[model samples]
Target: MLQIITEKFFPPGERYETLHRAILYTNYRVMRGEKIITPIGYLLPSTGLHSLATLTCEMLEKQEKYPDGPKLGVFVATTGDDLLNDFAAVISFFLNVTCTPDPDLTRRLLLAERPSLGIEAVPSRFIRRMFDKDVHARDGEAAALTAFIKQLIGLERETFVGAMRAIRQFVIGSHRLADDLNLAYTLFVTSIESLAQGFDGHVAEWSDYDPRKRKKIDGALKDASDEVAAGVRDAILSNEHVALARRFRDFAMAHVAPSFFRVEAAGAQGPISGPDLPIALQQAYSIRSSYVHLLRDVPRQLTISGFPEATEVDDRKTLSFAGLSRLSRHIIMQFIARGRIVEREAFDYRRELPGIVTVKLSPEYWVASTGGFDHKTAPVRLAAFLEQITAAVLQHQKDAKLTDLGPILTMVEHSVSGLRKPSQRLPMLTLYFLFHQFAGPEFSCKQWPALFEKHKADFDAPTVESFVAHLITGNRVEWTLEQLEELHKTYFKTRHTASVTKIGLLLEAALSLYVAEVNRLAGNNARARALVAFAVDSHPGHAALRTYEASLPAELAEINWTGILLPPRPSSEGPSADPVPAA
Candidate 1:
């Protein structure tokens, strides 16, 4: 029956994929109630004989005499679920149950056919006895094969040998029914893992291996995977065209096609260089290179697609400090790919922190190359970029749902316009991302110290200090203008703090008119009174009016009350002055 199936379904020297698929198809037909029966029925002689036993004996004999003879038994045994089980039973019975110590038969069986059937013949014994005395006779041959493989993996050897070793193991092991293709498949998929292990364990030996071996293994795996895929496609070709083709195309794109370029850039055949980098950025770049190059023990793979233009070719200059920072790895990869680099003068002094500069990658070559000199609406674009940074930062924090940062971004947008234009957006975003780093859930004063430290160079110390003071006071007053005044008044009264430098800072520019008026009437007692009145009108919290009056000389506080444009004081000696001041 096995012979008939093999002759009918499998051709000579057909690949494993074809045989496996044909068997699967035959099994499917049987399950679906096909009336077809195998033609080689006489080998069984009677229904009393175990079909598996007869099939195994015949296949063994044929294979020993003719190793290249056809692999028909696999198709017969695996196709019929019952046949495979019975085959194992019969083979086990002959090996152990019959208890015949015939050395020639065992040797012939072991040496005659391929190991694939022998593997299949083992699992039927309820327990594996392949390592027992009966199977031990073949150990010498197996050990030789294993030793050859061990040498193939050694370092200082040719990579081609390593690849050949793997392929040989796959082919030989696959031929055995009990070979555990799953394990083989796993090791096969990670051919690189084996190479890496060889490279680590025996570097000197691995060095002797062929350099082209890695490529060979990669090619072989890809070919095998492709063949498996083709078989799958053949089995399902009639099912769906568009969908199946699309799936196959996707699979091929993912596994077969190499999307990344793996060019070596070391020693002399390196990437194009650029201006020399500053020492600080150089250290950072070295770290970046190690990460990108897979110098570490753990394997790391990064997709360079996001940075298609990255890849600096050798033969140029190293990047400058500013260039290094301004050109992030993404941009650098592009630079490498393009054989170009950024200029040092392009970095802005105030905003050129390594963190900021490093994040400034942009594919917008126009903006990146011109350094922001050409665009008519560069300011607007700059603003938009800053807003993007703010949005990304806020995105990292969400309970507030502050989707629109237009107002605050608008305030700082001009900071980067014209002479202030930044070459990259990454730094801005990095800064923004960092904003939420130390910020409390409420984005409160917890971040003030660090914020001050970071921005101190860019912002006026007095200005930020006063702003913080105002915020603390403002928050205390629920940010209401009226409450702000009341709070100031209460603070002065309770704390006996006469100075209002902080408040004055908050109101400095807005109070210029009042300051000019006070200086105009300097040393005039009555004018001082008018000045105090003006202060009170502008800031009702300037309830310290009498204190201001006392601070001035008595004459200045009294001044000429009659002719001046000042309104009359609420006098105790006469009727109050008119509500309206003199025109």
Candidate 2:
């Protein structure tokens, strides 16, 4: 009966092969009238076994309704008699509920049981209930676990099941003799490798599906070429290393291991040493390979000895087993954590919007931003601006002594990439300007005005208009050296109000100086002094502008040209007050 069911439902695979052998073994015991006992209890009778077989067949036919039926059936048929009674009871309840008149209630019951079916299903209802109750107590964690399990079933069922089976065998072998130690170690390491592969798949999916993130990762990988090893470079760039145990070693070292566990350097005379996770994983894998390939003179003694006098080998095997076990658990926990984050991102609109935008714009902006003015084009513009500014600033920093601008530039880049609203773009630009003001030299002050003038048509009317109006207003205003000093202090601090006020004053001062220089060369000494007075009083305190003021003819400064506003221009734009003459 078991053979027929296996043939009909179970596919031709390693799992199915194991199920076939288990059923044959079970039948052989039954024919000899041998009673089996498991951890839970004694086995069921022939009649109960027949009933379970019949119900399992029915469930397999309706596999859509019982997606976990195949796995549960294999587990039940293969396990010892001690667990049979509980499994039999579960099968009986399922049969009864599913065959009842109230199909709706049956559906609800089945839906409720689905989460625990594939991974947690066991013979005993009591054990299953305890597990279910615990899961319910931690609903958030349970949801994440469920998502991980679902992902495992969909993308990596073979590896996931293989890991679980290996875990079970290791648990059974731990209590046995030293003969089983090799099997346990091999299974434990293999399980860790499988979980790491699953996590790698998750990360790959996230990268491939999200183009913006992929581009960023690619850029980082390119930048890392000179810093990382060849293998690591290939892994990061191609994502080929993620599925390997070596990658897990790197991940564990970075995120899981403590500082002391990472590396230990001996004295200058001794060789440097470290407890490298990847090296351990590699050694274990080599042992497994030796066993698989039937290598000659294989080392059965699982121990490392620095000297012959110290013959302590037994505990070494135990430690190896413990380390591998703990590592496997950590890998599984990391997978669960990653799944939880992905699940949260998928459902939360706020977290998903940026990725959505990336996906929508990827085709057009993959190489560069290529769209006209629109809501979608702002990010591209912001990206271009950030790139241009960052490159220019980095180049400037090479020769100039300045405060570090890397953090500010990084923040601006992140803010622009994550921008979802139009209002955020200006603030980001403002912050960029502030950083540039502090980090760049005197020449950098002219960069923003040039960029603003160049891109004025791209911005809204209000933004462009406000800037132009400030320039005009500054040219017509009169000022004293004290007021100019205050504006200089404010501008030095990169305060927004000061930036606005001082930028216009600086432009107006440059024009005034140009006019004064022209008049001075033409031998109009009085007109030159008047224009010099306006430039000095309106914008005298700036460190960069002070050079221009000092270069003016000495006679002009001795004349005490102060409190003048641009020599009273003609028409309605003329100065409101009389120009203060030399003292």
Candidate 3:
């Protein structure tokens, strides 16, 4: 029966004749109820049943001469009954299934054929033993083939697979099944748009339009009266088309086709690039809109005479649709490629610290330091540091005796107000602490006049001798008229020169000596001594402070200070300020 069927239905060729004999031999087993097993390689077009049969016949013709050689039974016994049944099923499927090849089936056949002559024929003994096994295996193979086909076509491998499938279907002419170019175009555009949305999610800025609109609405509500805000929100919601148009324009203008509007040349006669993508997309969208809305005019023109007219309007519309499809594919693929590059190049945004922490002394520390008047507007790092420092300071302040901190705090606040840079504030505050340690907590502006007054008699000579004596004595007295006038005009006034006379030397020496002792107690002895040395070497009066240093009380000179060491204040040429006694 197989021989007759092959002779009648199969094409008359060397290929068909060999395949015919293999089918006959396989069929004979089924008739005899003998099991037959088939190798997957026997399904290959070049090396399948035809090749197996040709090899088997060649071996058999020589068996008469050498009877002990390979036997035909070896090949026949393994070409199992299951293979026959599968072959039958395949045939029935081809006959019953639609005339058009199933994309899935075609894909499977291609993969099954891919192994470059590596797959081998089954051995008879093993084939007999696994006849039923091969039956189940065949079913599994079918499923695997379907999977392999999907893989081969590169579908279901990414987020944009559905879009790709639509494109693939159109390219392969499967779109003809529906014979609806309009619907095909719609699906292509829809898929492309879906891909664009996927691209948007992976990118920055492009993904923000909708959220930004919502944010705008949220912000408006904060300023509007309840009823007015509600009305405004309703108005915005009602005008979604306007918002969508604006968003589409922004995206199309920015990324997909930025050069869509550029002139082709540089001159007055240079042609303006026309039929712009944005405009084309607008028209494409209008067509889609017309289709969706079932506009009376759209259906009449689109369906007339079973085809669109060859008019200029129709040609332009068709061209626009084609352009949009091609553009979408280009844009999606470009973004996907861009997204990959971004993924490869992305880096962590965290920054390393500079290893120096500035302590904030008050609740408004960051504001005062940064000059950011409003706390909400402070720099992120500054604000964070402020919080950390404020917490630490408050915690430390809880344990420490904060006596006479009021005057010192006032000085710090006043100095901070005068400072320009945030970095300068911390060092200025450190200077305040050095001054507090030098003059004691009782220090304030009230003591200024008294100290100057005590030097009044010395200033009679208008000489340096009187100033050194006053500092060495540490006198407490109100400022006399002559002393106050001389001190204010000479030392405190703007554009005043450093007092180089004996009085100036004595004041500078005393200030530098006190600064050294304060810094030494704070554990920065080296820096403190360096500062004193620098002061003494730079100015003549500063040397007098070292000379008077030994005359200070032992307790004042030797008190043990235990705390974090503060960095030295930056150098300045003028004399450090005199201590102001607390009011």
Query: How many residue pairs clash (N, CA or C atoms closer than 3 angstroms) in each of the candidate models, in the order given?
Result: 58, 2, 15
Q: Score each candidate by Cα lDDT.
A: 0.28, 0.35, 0.33
Model 3, 43-145: lDDT tens per residue? 2211223211101111010001123444563211222333233333322221111111233332232223332131221111111111111112233443443
Runs in model 3 deviating more than 4 A are 1-178, 201-242, 245-275, 295-321, 341-583
Clashes of 3: 15
Q: What does the lDDT read for residue 212 in candidate 2?
A: 63
| Tens digits of lDDT, candidate 1, 50-150 | 11111111121011113454465432123333323232222232222111123343333333333343232332111223212223223243243233323
The TM-score leader among the candidates is: 3
lDDT of 2: 0.35
lDDT of 2 at 426: 52
lDDT of 2 at 512: 56
> Candidate 1's error at 367, in angstroms?
29
| Candidate 1 displacement at residue 47 in angstroms | 42
Candidate 1 least-lDDT 10 residues: 21-30
Model 3: how far residue 93 lies from native, Å? 28
TM-scores, all models, native as reference: 0.16, 0.24, 0.24
